[model samples]
Target: MQDFVAGARSAFLRLASHSASDSARSLWADPSGVRGVLRHRLAGPTSAIAFCVLLGAAALGVGNAAVFLGLAGFVAAQVLIARVLQHLGHRLRPDVGFRVVVVTWPIALGALGAAGWTAVNDYHGEVVSLIGLITAGLVALVEPTGFAIVWAVVAAAAVTTGAAVGGSVTGEALVSTGAIAVGAAFGERLRHVIEAFLGNRRELLEETARIPASRDPFQTAERLLQPLVRWTPVKNPSLVWFTPDGRSVFLAVAGNNLPPHLAAGRELPEARNAYMRRQAEQGPWTSGWTVVDGDEGYTRGVASLGIQAGAYVPLVHEGRLLGLLTAGWSAAGGDHSAMAEYIPALVEVAHAAATALGPGLAELEQRSTASQVVDDVLHGQRYWPVYQPIRRLRDSTLVGFEALTRFDAPVTTQRLFIQAGLVGRLRDLEIATMRAAVMEARHLPEDCWLSANASPGLLVDTDLLASILEPIRQPVIIELSEHEVITDYKPIAAALGRLGPRRSLAVDDAGAGFASLRHILEVRPAHVKLDLGLVQGVATDLTRTALVAGFVRFAHDAEFELVAEGIETQEDLDALTRLGVGLGQGYLLGRPERASAAASNENAPRGGRAMGASRVRSRTARTRSQAGAIAASRTTTPAH
Candidate 1:
């Protein structure tokens, strides 16, 4: 019985809340709203005028023009005054008192009765009951539900009593009183139905006018949360966005005073771990406020910031938790508790913000993950650079070495560069790799130039340019690839010029694109390395042979040494030698190797073999007579 009673009581509270919501949305109090547009009880005065004339005529007859004229004149004057008041109300800013008109409705009823009494004879009790029916119906259209019911009761009893006091010699007043009372009850319900329609229309217009764009969803969500922030005394308000992996969450937006510990990124507060667990198991608290501990336990680390407590509202979509919208306060804990009545409204606002922020969060999460990957690579201690020998084809000598970076992750070379650039860490990675390559020079044979690759943007960077000026045992060759476009030649040329005579610049992948050729002409480097595309099948493919032949001629005339890369087979080597290429590097010549002690000690066969034999492979290269023949042919061959 208690449970049933509690359910019944809860239901009644909902009904009352809903009715109050309807009335508040109705805008009857707002002079610039629908009620204002309708001029508040719009048809009430006009209908009152029509009733007064009819009642006065029925009692006095047309021949009694004196009393009838007075009634008609009074009705006209009231109509004019109502119109004037409506116009003034619209013209003013603070709005005229529209609610005052609801009270005047009873006066209109009394006036109608007076008009009947002044004109009539012997229909006393009958006149009172007639006024009751008209007043009830008219008040339904003119006033809100509560006012309509009260006016109906007052008009019925007042008119009936006045007739009896006049001693019209009729006992009919008793019977007619019941008729007036019943009309009041029905009239109130009729007013509520009419008000509900108007209320719905007002709410629809309000929402449509406020929200215009969702292009910047985070900003839009913040703007949407402002109303709730003002209503609640929150010191900190934030919308947290979950990452794709769900391992981390970034503060999409922060409003007001944010807790120092919470900052901008969070997966979940450790303090709320228990709170969330209970909510997950028992279902969340559907209503009321949850007080966050603001005492020493909560305030421990952030003691200086003085955050007393917090309130978190879950942002749920389709039963999945997307994020939390939180509010922090430095005030009394009971402040948020006092706002328990507004919890549902505040939650509704959180729902709207979370919805707008969904797509925005998705985009941020992907970018944030990419940034995290870059940071992990730099600080992870899992990545290192290895050397691949660049051999001189004439003597098969290890003339130079190019550093190739490797990571434990399976990400491709292109993806690594792209992901690093996404986080603005590409230069940092490039500098790290270049430094590693320079360190390898200590383990290498003397006179072997250490070649390191860099993008065009990194070449002009001050730190990299400064690093290029550092003294080394051998010539340092900087190879900028053709994959990136050289946007400005002047700065790269200027920065490279500062490296002095010991440094050499090589335009890598010369046959890859026009940009590499541009790099050769504008920067006028010491060497040009032909791309794998031209060198891969040069012995068989005529077009590849022609392209390499053209690059060889260009390199010679431009006073730059030519190198052909990707020479995996003997045929490719012979072909490149025939093409007058002096240098090459590929897996066939020497695999990239790590020079660590552990690699050799563990007897990791393939890894150790590569490390120990990296220099021996360069020594084992059989001097090709074809390479000398290619040089002879290059001096003799015609344009073909």
Candidate 2:
């Protein structure tokens, strides 16, 4: 008995479920179902106006108070129903809201039929029939076919029954029923055309809106396939991107139900070969589904994966193919005729995908090219260092040479370093350049010092600095640029100290900003280089002159050498000399040249005299003494 009861309950639930499903399917059968029609912007206002017209007609013609009240109440109910429909339009999905409208709309029309019957019978009035005709026409124009059919049947029956009972105007009742049916058929056709137009328009707008903002090709392809997969019979939508050389392809993204052999990120050499051959033979692959039973490489592979029908659309921009967009169906064997109508839409989506993927692919190609260039440069050691003369301004004697890197490649030196940094090989490149400069510095004159630029992060590593500088015999000055951010300077100071008495720290690009001042106070280097901005117009600009004067005074009091950079004019050079600036480097003094040429004094400044070797030795000793004094003071100062 328990088994029997359980079986009965199960059967009842299944039946109820099937019934609900069937009802829902029937309600949503039309293209723009009841919900879509009612939620349109004009639906509510049109219905309200019709109801008001009916109320006015009844009030003017009908003498029966109860019938007039019934019409007024009906109009009020319609206004309330319009409000509910408006609310549901926003809060509920179209199909779910269709269920609500199906129940409410039919019952409201049935009540109207009843009111019409009462007026015709009791008051001998014909305004009710006219009002019924107007309502029936409105319903046919906007409501679904099934909904219009139900309303037509109810209204015709009401009119026919009234005529038969009154024993008058049977022919008129017949004519009225036929007119409603005709109006319904015409309106349904019009509704189908309108719905199709609106649907296409909305799809186009959505595609246009989403394509521009997308930067990731894989993500954008996935988004483009979503609506297509949901609305069409296609399954397992996937995108395969070609390599930059167009010699290989990989599955970059996929939707659900993808076959194991076609998993994302997997390379497909056979697919790439087949696509290349077809593209060479034909112009481009058009958008359409075809059966996958052929012996071709891609087709056989797809057929083995259980995809009976497939479509491949080439994502082309500027006559170059970047990728392929594909869709497949497992059960569409021997009959894909049903997919013909969707071909145009599929083509539109493929075009949008191509337009969106162009910029992203171009960016990827550029980065790949940049990375390859850096790799070539590093592997081949295709860069060399040139030395620029740093001269004492009063005597125009070469004090030292600053080592700067130059690349043989087309890219600028600064841009090359920046690119290397982006690829996380900045330190490696810096160390390589430093090693090259150290090797070349052996050719320099014995007395002059060598200054080289090093970032703080690299300079702070004592072990690395020792590996490059320990074997060098000449005086070495390691320059730290003030533009670079250094959270702590103690490590750099300690690194220089560990390199023995030959290594001195110099602050580069001083007077550019506040960071330089902080560097001076903290690092207490042996030399300070003035930024070009302060030195370019120092002879004329009072502000610049004042600033250079202050730096000169600070250098005198601090006992460190102040070098003016970029002294282009005689006036600026004279002004720096008058202001007590001891050293300067610029095009006016000497331009950068090969280390061999610079060591031979081939590129020396005009009217300049080289310092005596003894004098150079004495100045180096004094600079070293001052650096030691500054270090001692910093170490002994309290940390207030």
Candidate 3:
């Protein structure tokens, strides 16, 4: 029962909202609707004038002064009501204006009925009552069918009562009541016809305003403009698609008769005249179209191109100015008078063009935004580096720090890189970030080393890599992700080879995919870092423990150091140490921090042995043995 009550309540609220919306639309939204007909046809100053003439005829023919005064009072009251409605039309909000119209409508009808009641006994007075009934039906045209019927019935009752009080026959009262009922029914039918016509027009406009499927802006412009040139008196039509900034045109396409300067692929600085430029920027929905004569000073430039008249239409969608559509006529084509007749049709075509070009314009805007973001990061130097400490798992001593990029903008590091790649500035962004990391590495402790990330493509550019890495005085490892697909590793290997003995290569995210094994065999990196997924649950998961053991065996045989990433728990760290993993990094060891904080040893493990003692005993002995084995293996094997 509670669920049923809740459902009924929701249904009722929806119905109420829908009815209110319908009422607002029918009363004031469309210019050709019932509200417009009431203001212009039935309740304007012309209606006031007609009432005044009727007042004069009543005063001249009637001998009863009281009846004449009552009739005159009705006319004055109706004129005042019409004036008030017209005066407040622009001042009130739509809903408020609708309420005012509804409240005043019945009052005006009541006044007319009173005048009809005042003179129902006389022969000339019958004409007055009949006219009042017709006016009451005309007023009903603006009301809902139910309200119109109720108000008409009340007015008919007043007329009938007055006829009986004046000693008129019963048949006469029935005739007066029947007249009002018939008028109300006729008025309701007329209102529905007008509303139907407006609804059809609105639907037609919506159908024509649909987005085109083409992604190319030029093709979209050409397809939309062809209909305008074919159907109307416009002999020459041109479309100027604007750039995202709205400061310049990226593409301009014109009909055959237009000058060569306005041809396809040409950029236009602005529209022909200041008015056209202003109207285009503000959009057609706000400023409408601007028609210019050939002889005008502002149009002299186009006149020289044999164009006699022109109309500028702005292509706007959802308040964004996408482009401008201009239609022109030559002397042989037509004059301003001939073109004026077809201006409405030209506007319809321009509206259709705006809708069809929405997708292409949106894409251009997004690309422009991405380009700007990349430029700010590269040229403005808005990026910096943070360091996450790497530790020796057995002793918990800080071994090295991996430098990662951070930005001033409120965007993810990966997203910035992706945006840069889209704008063809990926290399520039990578190089800039690497250079910043290398510069900040000067602040690190003398005993600690640094590892920085680089793509295979960036490593292939040996000269660019050398310029960034050569300045660092400490040992540096260029870490490459296993996710990148490298068809040729010779260029990258040669680039690292030229960086001298201080620089070494590290294969990052090992054991994450099959490609990491291929990268290990091909590049023969000095260090292979286990992927986080393998290390996260290595404490209990036998499958993850087995994978770590395999990497540990391979690292020993290949003469490479093994590091486990993302050791978040103490159990995982102990598990990795038991598996013979020598180096690791994660939140359990130290989070990434700036150079000053990271280099101060504040982020080091709380009760671990210092690097000085550990380096002398275990790490140095292992490094010396690995270096010796690496040298011997390289001499026997071919270069990768």
Candidate 4:
């Protein structure tokens, strides 16, 4: 069963075994193979030296050969220590399918000493050669490459000792040590090459398996990571999907360390390699691996036992990269070959997982779209206006229209719009809509102005102004909403500063909030539109009447026009006129008419004391005249 398990079509095992064996023979049959198996070949002179020391020690204590063997053992022990140091430095694991062979130098040396003492006590000359051979074999097991060095050292030591102390030089001993070192070196070299070939072949087979099984790239990453986690603990198991632009974004279905910016519109880090190699779109997926050791047990905790070693496998499905799968060994206790052996399997699983996650990916995209829609709305994407006419207070002559927003698409919920913090967008939208309505209005009175709502944000949104200016050439009245009073008003003020001298501003819904009243005083608008709630019952309430009359008087004193909205009764009109209000707009004055009708009234009537209508027209005319003056000033200003 062991043999079957060892040989059962595993390219890794076969390759490793073959490469080791080949490395042993490469020195003789193919020197180039020596380089391939240099790490494993034991072709060195240390073995020969070990042999020489053993014989010398044996001769010195002819009556106690065991003591000599003990000395030889000490030298062998040193060599094993060297081999261990090399292993730790390289982080290479023991050969695959095998346990870590830790031939401790202390134990081996002790054995050598005991054996030599026994040989001397037995007066056995053969024991001398035996010591040389045992040391050679031990060194071979530890580091096949060290064999030559071991053999050469042992041979010289043994020959010298035999000649000087024993008064005899055994050609056989010299020959044996030499032969073993050379043979082991070549054999291990050959073995190493075959192992590599077999390993590559096994990987090809695994890749093929992955091709059919790839269903969900992300899940495959999880599956690939599972065994790694079991073997080596990781703080977080996350995958990065690299883009061609060197950006590596996380495919974070199972990890918590991902950054929020990644989910927004930020691309992955540019250092990601899959993008550079264009392997993100290729199969036999180019796998990129990187390992990080965090401070204070971040990646080195008790939970992460097998993660001392890490491997990353790139996930590619049908030439498209799904992401990357990384797994590590938490503790320092695994074979390097075993670690390498697992990489192919991980790559396959990642491919499978990515392919399977199609439905989830689609859902994620939908959510992304919804989020974008909300953002675009808030930023005023494609928002614009349509115009409705306002009658003149005195002549009811062709007057400007109230610019209103007609959403291209039905936006049913005002709550949704406001909650999105997009009221600013609506203001800009209203402005654009007004500009468009005026530009398209068939015969807008040449001297009339368009009244449009404005949010404080519009002043700061230079881009929004740029858009409107590209298509608009008429005077514009920017009506400030009550809420705009509290928002950052500087940008709006700055924007207003840029408006042609002729443009004017108004405070809309003036009495609804004290904020609006303050804004009107600060902005010094050409007009103030009293809130419908404030104006509707003004005729009946004396206190309200007194307050409104005060506002009307204030408007006149401040050289500002007053317009009343929502006049439903004759009493409302009569009271407003009595209050000295100028412009009146509501059912009594006339419903808001289309732009075309408002522009071409040849016999427009003169209404009586309609404070709101008069206020609106007066503001409009003043705004247009101001805009014309500003344009004239600009034409005359000296160019920088």
lDDT of 1 by residue, 55-106 (tens): 8547644445554454465556455545655555345321222333333433
Candidate 4: list runs displaced more than 4 Å. Answer: 1-385, 394-398, 413-435, 460-474, 485-497, 600-640
TM-score of 4: 0.38
- What's the number of clashes in each of the models? 1, 0, 0, 120
Q: Please state the error at residue 191 of candidate 1 in Å.
A: 9.3
Query: Which residue pairs collide, candidate 1?
Result: 294-308
Candidate 3 lDDT tens digits, 1-640: 1222222222222223234455344334433223343344335432453365366556556556656555566556555665567456545544455446545554454445444454445544554544445544444543447756665665455454555455355434543454444334434444454345344434544544543647777777776665554444465577767665545452544555554446676555345433456667653321122335542333444455667656566777777777777766663433343233233444565678777777876876666777898787677877777787898888878879888766755455556676777778877888887888888878887577888888888777778788888778879888888778888888878888887898899998998898888889988999999998898888899999988898888999999999888766666777888899999986667756778889997444521343333323432333443453334222110001
TM-score against native, each model: 0.54, 0.58, 0.53, 0.38
Ranking by TM-score: 2, 1, 3, 4
Regions more than 4 Å wrong, model 1: 1-221, 227-238, 243-268, 273-285, 292-322, 325-380, 393-397, 409-417, 455-458, 461-471, 483-486, 511-514, 537-549, 569-575, 595-640
Whole-model lDDT values for every prediction: 0.55, 0.62, 0.61, 0.49
- What is the RMSD of candidate 3? 14.4
Clashing pairs in 3: none
Give the lDDT of residue 419 in candidate 2. Answer: 72
Considering TM-score, which of the candidate structures 1 and 2 is the better prediction for this target? 2
Query: Per-residue CA lDDT of candidate 2, range 1-640, in tens?
Result: 1222222222222223234454244223421233334543223433463565466566666667665565666656556675687477446554455445435554554454454455455554355555555555555554547746665555545554454545345534543453345334434444454456447645754754475635565566666666665555566666667767544444344554444546655666565556554663352232333434432454455655565655566777777777766666564443433233333455556667777777777766656666877788779888777777888888887788888766666565556676777667778888888888888888888688989888887777778877887655689888888778988878878877887888898898998999999999998999999998899889899999999999999998988999888666667777899999999987666656677988988345432334223333433443553453344222110000
